[model samples]
Target chain A: MKAVYKRELNSYLNNPMGYVFLGIFVLFFSVIFCYINLYSLVSSNISYTFSYMIYAMLVLMPLLTMRLMSEEKAQKTDQLLLTAPVKASSIILGKFFAAMTLVLLALVFTLPHIVILVIQGNPGFLVTLLAYIGFILYSSVYVSIGIFISSLTENQVISAVLTFAIFMGLLALEILFVPGIQSPTLYKILSGISFASRYSDFSMGVFNLTSLVYYASAAFLFLFFTVRVTEKRRWA
Target chain B: MIEISNLTKSFGKHKVLDNITFRVGEGEVLGFLGANGAGKSTTMNIITGYLSSNEGKVLINGINILEEPEKAKKLIGYLPEQPPLYLNMTVSEYLDFVYQLKGIKLNEKAEKGEKSEKQQHIEEICEMCGITGVYKRLIGNLSKGYRQRVGLAQALIGNPEVLILDEPTVGLDPVQIIEIRNLIRELGKKHTVILSSHILSEVSAICEKVIIIHNGRIAAASVTDKLIKEFQDSNRLRLTAEGDAQELVKTVSVIYGVDSVEIDETKTNSSAAEIIIRTSKDVRGPIMSRLVEKNIGVINFGLDTVSLEDIFLKYVGGESDEGSIQERAE
Candidate 1:
């Protein structure tokens, strides 16, 4: 796990893709930060920072996660990782944790906006912390989904395009569910499924355990599916 | 020791390895020979735990690969047809990472690991594979032979007991082929090395025992010398003589120690003929004397010996059967 983690992290940092992802993410965040905190007069709420992140992440998450498995498959490097003396779960988690760490680092860099809020106004840090947790959880879900989608194909372009489509569908699951469903019960269950619905409560200063469980477990499902997908390809 | 019993792999209904069985003793070099698409790589992949066999068992040093893959994989190191390298990394970077992947510790001792002796082993493998000069270079920049060595070096890390390499010498120049063969030979003294190749001479030169696979089944399995001996008579000769072909044939057929003779007039010049001699055992000396005494002046005589190529062709055929997967279920 340590070796996989170290190597993956190093590859990201050493390769140009790392810089591209970090730059795109930071650049977009800074633009939103200036608009939300500086240009606006009453800049007390740091939670608005997250609203900007969603739009950014719709583009940003795929950048980091699209190549996660697709590139490995393309390069035939997955053969090394899969054939090593490591369990399937360890491999899945190792990759998950490494990509999560990168996303966390980028999220951590968003701290300055919150620090300014605290310095200028006595804003609730709890709400801000909850919002940040929501950010990580939400991005992790996308990362796993992207990884799962990446595993389904060898071509990076196809992986990237299909991942975008799947993500758009996840983002719009609510709209698709309506008029088709006749029950309020089904509506609530699926409303609980979207990243926007699950994350909205957290961004509103509420950290719900149900939402937390939903995101974590969904991530696990994707990881599990990713393993099965990879294993299936070996036989195919 | 490596044992593969009743091993079979299939993609859907297509069987790639069909009930193949073989055993390699410790420190033995086993050469896997087949024509292209003969399922050599498929068998190797299953043994290395890279691909699961639809049915069968692979045991390395007494541990089953399927039941306990992690522990079993620890005992074996593999270099696939492609090196499975991260070309973005330097050779040292790739190996250090491989060493760590096998759970070899890099720093302070864990409860149990190979961290203490890790660097020396890495360096030693680097030297053994002749990649020391290119250790600092990115793997992508190295030549095909160097990339192959790096892959070999990765397989050698952590002192694995069994090494499975597929077409290990595929892209090498003649000199590099000899070097890699020598290295494999030297390693065979300590490790059970199993490699596959389509080149017959390479197998004849390196292997003690050879398994010839054709159409996903074992066509022949024997010691290399016996396979050659069965087909080639070492002291046999073919001669063209200035005489009636049938008369020459009748004379040579009666000679002592002459095993069998075939006379052909179609390929002969006027007043001459060609006769192929097969001694019951290697008896070229007696056969030649008898032929000369017949006064059928020997036009030309040349000794013939069956080569590995002939045996391989006879078994695998000139063009290997175009094999395919039947998409069998697991």
Candidate 2:
């Protein structure tokens, strides 16, 4: 697991991928941070930054996870991993955490926003901390979804596009439930399943255990599916 | 040691491996000979735990590969037809990754002795595979031969008891092919190696035991030389003499115990003619006297054995849609 993790992490860092992801993420994050906090002078609430970061992740996380499994399959390097002594689940988790680490690294680069908020204005530390936790958990669900999509195909472009499409649907789930589709029960059930809905509690300064469980279970569910897909592909 | 028993596999309706059974003992070099799409790669994949068979089991040293994959996989190293490599990584990094993937603790090995045993083992493998010079370079920049060496090095990293190399010399030039063949020969001294190739001479040169697969079934399996002798052509003798080609052919055609006679165009020219006599008996003395009595100047003569190419073509039946003997006749 460590071998896979280190190799995957190095692949991101050793190439332009890590830098490109970080650069684009920080640029977008700063633009949003400046427009919301500096320009609007709404420095009291930092949750807006966390909420926008989730949107940023809907695009960027796919980029990080798209090539994770698909590239390995295309290059036939999956043979090495599949035949290695490690369990298939461990390989999946190792790659999962490697992509998560990049997300964390990109988040780390956005740490200056917190510093600037702390220095320049009245910042809500507790809310900011909770929102950061919320952002990690929320982004993990998408990251897992991305990794799962990557495992479904050997084409990286297809993986990326499918992940983006699924994430767009999930991000728009709340709006999807807005109109009258004549199914209230279905709306309530789907709204409950909406990952974006569960995340709203965290950014609103409420640490609901149900929301936490929802996001955690969503991440676990996707990761479980990813492992199953990979295992099934070996037979295939 | 590896044993595959009644192994069967299929991709949906297309059966890839059909009730194949074979075994390789410790320190035995087994060669798998097959044409393209003959289930060679599929069988190797199943043995190495890369793919699961539909209705069979592969055992490595008596440990079932599917049931105890990690334990069995630890005992084997595999190199697929294409060398699986991360082009972005340097050779040292990729090898280190593979070494760790094999579950060898480098720190523990380092703690065991003065210097790092992990590094030492990797260096030794590099030296053996002749890739020491390219250890620091990225795999993408290296030539195909070096990439192949890196793949070989990856397989050699854990020093697994068995090595499964699928068409190890498929795309290499003649010189590179010979080099990899020598390396496999050297590796066979300590490891139980199973390699697949379409080239018959390669198998005859390096493998002690050869198994030929045709259309998802084992067409033949035996000692390499024994297989050669079993399907070998009829014995023949060739005599070069300074005589008329037609006269030489007609003279040898009437000899008793001689099956047939034909002028050896390869050896015949204006100054001399060569006639090959197919026979099951030793008529060398009679033939020599007959040539001398005819006043024909004899240059050289010798008996020829069947080449492995003939045996392979006979067994594989070439690409012709006919019986093996009919194909051989063609």
In the range B1-330, model 1's lDDT, one tens digit per residue, is: 899999888777677889999999998888898877779989988897888887889898889987898998988889999999998899999998998889976453434554446667788999999999999999989998899889989999988889898999988999999999999988888889898998889988888888898878998888899988888666578888887887887887787777788865567766789878777665656667887776668878876667888888888666634432221222
| Candidate 1 DockQ, CA atoms | 0.76
* RMSD of each candidate relative to the true structure: 3.9, 3.4
Off by over 4 Å in 1: A175-182, A234-236, B106-116, B239-254, B263-274, B280-283, B290-303, B321-330
- Reference-based lDDT, residue A82, model 1: 78
TM-score of chain A of each: 0.91, 0.95
Which residue pairs in candidate 2 collide?
none
The digit string of per-residue lDDT tens for model 2 on B206-313 reads: 999999998789988999988877755446787888878998888777778788888878878888998878887888878878878878888888776677677767
Kindly list the per-residue Cα lDDT of model 1 for residues A1-236, writing each as its tens digit: 88888888898899987778888888888788788867874676666777768877877777777777888888878778877899866777777788898998887777777778788887797888888888888888889998888888888888888888887777666557653787989876777666777788887888799989988998889899998887776566
- In terms of TM-score, the best-performing candidate is 2
**Model 2 spans with C-alpha error above 4 angstroms:** A178-183, B106-114, B239-243, B254-256, B262-275, B297-300, B320-330
Candidate 2 lDDT at B320 equals 45
